[model samples]
Target: MSTKFPEIQGGGSLILAWQIKGKEVLVVAAGRIVNLLNADAKVTVVCPRNGLNEEVAYRVNNGQVKHVDRVFLPVDLEPEKKVAMVLTAIDDPDASTRIWKYCKQMKVPANIADVPSECDFYFGSVHRDGPLQIMVSTNGNGPRLAAAIRRQIGQMLPEGTGDSVKRVGQLRRKLRKVASGKTSRDISKRMAWMSEVCDKWSTDDFNDMDDEDMDKLVRYYESGEVPSFEEIRLGSRDHVVWEFDGTFGWM
Candidate 1:
């Protein structure tokens, strides 16, 4: 039977693939565990005295568990002693509930993979380009659909977009340094300067920038050379007003 669950709206860190690196994670299950070794999260897989641990021990190449135990001891629940994140992929619902409740009491974040009602967090579909990352979440309701949409969005992004992102970040740092050293206190002027720089930088211009081009552009911006107001007006497109009064209730 289908039931309607109340939707909770909140904002928190949308974890990226690289963010969990070097953190400790625990997976409790009886079968093959999906590999998380690439993320560099130290993973510990717990199972019964069966051969499940032995089978996994033979297959994995990197980030494999240093210790595979038959039971999770009570001492493991200590706030400072436990892993940062726990994932329960066990087939039993009752076991998942018990484990999740224990984790909650310990103030540890946990997820039951497909069992959203029992999870503190849901894994979202992620796409990455260097430092740039995009995450799509259906609030733990539709993971496969999220993955499909992520792939579509990934395909639409231009090649070398990550490089452009890096260049823009460098530009921002330069602008901030220049502002701190000499720019006026007027916040509006600073915003206008940013908009002008962004307005002149077209898609084609970004695509054409090689290492030499990027260096030159960086130097030009860092030199605190501002074009005349008339020149900026002539070169830039008119900014559009985004009216969200009707759409955003919070506004």
Candidate 2:
């Protein structure tokens, strides 16, 4: 007999702590979620053959992940390895709920693609800087809105932000004493100056900064307790906190 379950009016979510890198992960999606993420971690995609064969599977075929022609069945994938995260993008609530229960039993973190309330962790619209990364997410409820914001942020960034950060990272690693914190604050300050410089740099400024100027900038970052904002040469430290507006009436 089909009994109706009341739909929860508002959404709730949790961010479970589990790093999927080199760990088993099961993805159950008929959509593009798996394709886009390229199955991070030791990933496997299980979906109906027709829908799963899209670009996502193509990428997976490059030794990114293994694929099984099936729907979501927790028993099929041995979660004993404590697979890191299971992603489900299906529209079926029961299927999503079942996947959630399976993760709990296996002690694995799970994220049901579009279902944040049933997830352990939520994905972010990322802004990466090698080891320095900035991520923004709205718990998966509003990915379109999140994506729009991400585009706006892209425009705000200076040209060659990636190149600039990469250069900074190489320098930071080379200074052994600084890497070990002998000059941690100094290196941090230099990084700050670099950010300011990058932010306000004119087309000519970027083209003209010589080896001497770059060295001076590094010294400025390392030599000071206070990094002036005018010299911020890298990225923004600003953050957007995600919080739910509490207005729920229990069913």
Candidate 3:
């Protein structure tokens, strides 16, 4: 007997974080312009002055984004501009469809807000804290449900989780510097050590670590020694007086 379940159709959208930094993005209307701006996209909103909501107006006035002060024309998608993507939230379905066709012809990605079929991608409800970002998507089924789930997940995450992530990143960079020129086996060992540290250490333990503690951890990596959590927290390796100059070694 075949063990495979019956196939389900639809919902095959791939979730991704598009890197639009410093790239031109043509926004047909003002509704989703803020999201584009937040991603560091060089946004140019092609909408009437009256169409702009308060927030968008503020951004335009502040010179955060360029404003065209007119409705979107097919000319806006001219090849020389090299638009990375397009986002439209206009009320006119015909105009939106026209823009979508132009985007397709130009091979540019687009999101036509509320019209999932026309969108090449859907925006997720994002929860951000410093370097840590969690995005929840419903694959264009129910945005509200996705937002609710994101809220619950955010509430469950421990406080200072972002700080812990930043700390771990610093530790990883330090370990790489200390383990420089080591063999492939040694590199694998260092990776294993980092994995162990992440598994064994709590968020509180990472948040509690300061620069001095990080230095000691690097020393442990250099010597192929692993210290207990309590030993690291209590500065048991303080007497060794470790310092990183060129590479981490006994000084």
Per-residue accuracy of model 1 over 89-114 as CA lDDT, tens digit each:
76778778888888888888888766
- Check candidate 3 and list the clashing pairs: none
The ten-residue window of minimal lDDT in model 1 covers 228-237
Candidate 2 error regions (>4 Å): 1-19, 30-40, 76-80, 127-133, 177-251
The TM-score of candidate 1 is 0.62
**Can you give the TM-score per candidate against the true fold?**
0.62, 0.61, 0.82
Question: How good is model 2 by TM-score?
Answer: 0.61
* C-alpha lDDT of residue 246 in model 3: 69
Among all candidates shown, the one with the greatest lDDT: 3
How are the candidates ranked when ordered by lDDT, highest leading? Answer: 3, 1, 2
List the candidates ranked by TM-score, beginning with the highest: 3, 1, 2
Candidate 1 to native Cα RMSD, angstroms: 12.4
